[model samples]
Target: MSDTLLKPHPLDEATYLRSLGPGRLAGRTSAAYWNMAGPFGGTTAAILLRAVMEHPDRRGRPVAQTVNFCAAVAEGEFEVLVRLVRDGRSTQHWLVELVQGDVVAATASTVTGPSRETWSHRPGAPPPMPPSQALAPLPTEGRNAWLGRYEFRFERGEPIPGRASAEAPAPALSRAWVRDAPPRPLDYVALAALADTFVVKILQVRGDIPPVATVSMTTYFLADEAEMARQGEDYLLCTADARAFKHGFNDQTAELWSAGGELLAVSNQVVWFKG
Candidate 1:
């Protein structure tokens, strides 16, 4: 128990938050958090969303966003360039790119739309799972540092080390309750990051934690500010499943739900994995 271990995570404060710059926004990298490769994809996504949210010309709220990982990000200062694609009466679109030392690490497209009321019907079924309090907390000992920032109460698919042996292979699905540890407010930026929080789908299905990286990720936001606030810091029900795995690549889909049975966001990604 030392003061060094008790300090807030670099990302917990202003790490991903960017400052306005000449032609592009500028931001610093987090020194305390890193995955097997580079900075966590969740923080990367949050920064991309922050670029759009802070843009002077940005209109409406976030509806959908897609981030493509082009290369590994360097651990230092980076620049984010955003361009307004289309500005409609009710909706707006944007394109963003994050660059570090002339290398484009990530690119994204975001769509925002004003809120309106109309007749609507949801055909989706409610989330079928036990309460968050009923689930057991997953152990995190030797995993990436970023995984330790969030609390996961897993209903299934814990990715225990020995469970992935050749004799007993876990299913390719994960159902869990997830949320930030210190209870941050729910917003598009936070939710966008959370959408990518699930463990890579390939590991759960293939029963081995191999090298994994998300090549591309697309997310659709379903809830508004009210619904997001209603959920608060309560654990969100989340599930991720691999749809296909072939040729060193896999496609996965994920969904996040509110405690009161509301769909918060849905995400799909194509990931590169090693056997």
Candidate 2:
């Protein structure tokens, strides 16, 4: 009957945290967002951000977060250790770590601060793309469990069906309409996860799913809570691209845009792939 007892959506359930003590919270992995090896890295990042959001000392909204995947997180209980690094008049900084027993599985640095009214401009525009309704949703029934958690309609790059033998590599770019499968209103938490949903750029460029892991990912939230809520359940025009792949590492950058063309978030990551 209390708000605390309400059952959250699958995405929220995956990222849900329960206060344990000062600066600590408990959570568990969910089957809904399972990836090839572990829970989706995005969910991991979201939960870390959630810890900070729920912290008593938190201020403002999420400005940015950098999640570093230290090791594979096994499905089970985990503890998040949240440290309030500093709280300034306008900005709050935090350090968070996800611990599985004795080992730290992931760590994050986050910034939360109020957005002030100011002159703003973005030079780049959301790339042109057909309406989300114009394309068929990517099939997800038999793919990774996490794939079913979202709806993806590609306007430009879709992952190759399988390995490709083309002598030339495809351009490492994809533009698509993306949103939660069950249609949750946009929020910083949802935006954080959506920012990670771009099919890893290596799959888009090389046409093969290799043994890959995102070692580090950083997301910058541009839209404030009111702006995100105004998006309702509309799909975000999301895009991802890679600059280079060499020496077993690849660089990827992505942008998420609201249906009305507001830039919601920007993300970049370093991926390690094995042939």
Candidate 3:
């Protein structure tokens, strides 16, 4: 095969790893997902999860993952160390750390397990939105590189910096159709990264970028492998909103629904900010 055909996709390249030893791997940040001060938080989370998923003892699929941003990850090589906290018959718990030099830049915990057949129901329905083709994708030219990685079609609450002020605070709510720009198939690693694409909820309310960092984020994957496979290259309906912004911190929640209206994932995050 030609080398060109063997090349990895940008997302795969960004999350690619080289095993240094058991439970330890090496990776480098990608410019494609760079943010203001460091790599985009989503890609950071994706690589950390990738470390665990690539582990030999890993079982089942991703069920839940929580990542804590301890320090801004500088662009360059880093190390991911994964530890199997507990390996149960039905569930496996993992602890992972992303280290650049001696400083621990980020840490994460993940849960993976097999699914059992049982009765299920989804009471909450996907929010109403026109088909993805009906709306234009958010323009990304000359914006943050990460913003261009995904195609977003806002149904409501397009972020306009400085739209909110003390006298009038806009609600921090948004609903949109979102998918990877190059249309990658849905999977746990991609889903984990996509879960973090929402603009911070506080940004929606304040309508501006502040000195903000996501301190912690948790995502729960509801779909199994078969479910994710069925969602190939299709837009997922995504919605994000925040309840309050005070004490230099805020919280946001989001939901991702498949094109067919099945709830795919739910994510919540806590962010610290400064004026």
Per-model TM-score on C-alpha atoms: 0.91, 0.95, 0.97
Poorly placed runs, candidate 3 (over 4 Å) = 1-6
Question: What are the lDDT scores of the predictions, listed in order?
Answer: 0.81, 0.90, 0.90
Query: Tens-digit lDDT track for model 1 on 20-116?
Result: 7633888877754577878889888888888888888887789999999999988788889888889999889999999988799999999998767
Question: Which window of 10 residues has the lowest lDDT sum in candidate 2?
Answer: 160-169
lDDT of 2 by residue, 1-275 (tens): 97745767789889989989999999999999999999998899889999998898898999999999999999999999999998899899999999999999999999999989999888979998888999999999988999999999998888865544336578888899999978888888888889899877777777777899999999999998778888999999999999999999999999999999999999999999997
The candidates, ranked best first by TM-score, are 3, 2, 1
Candidate 3 residue-wise lDDT, 136-232, digit = tens: 8889888889888899999888776788865687888899999987778888889999999997766567777878999999999999878898899
Clash pairs, candidate 2, are: none
- Model 1 scores worst on lDDT over the 10 consecutive residues at 9-18
- Tell how far residue 259 is off in model 2, in angstroms: 0.5
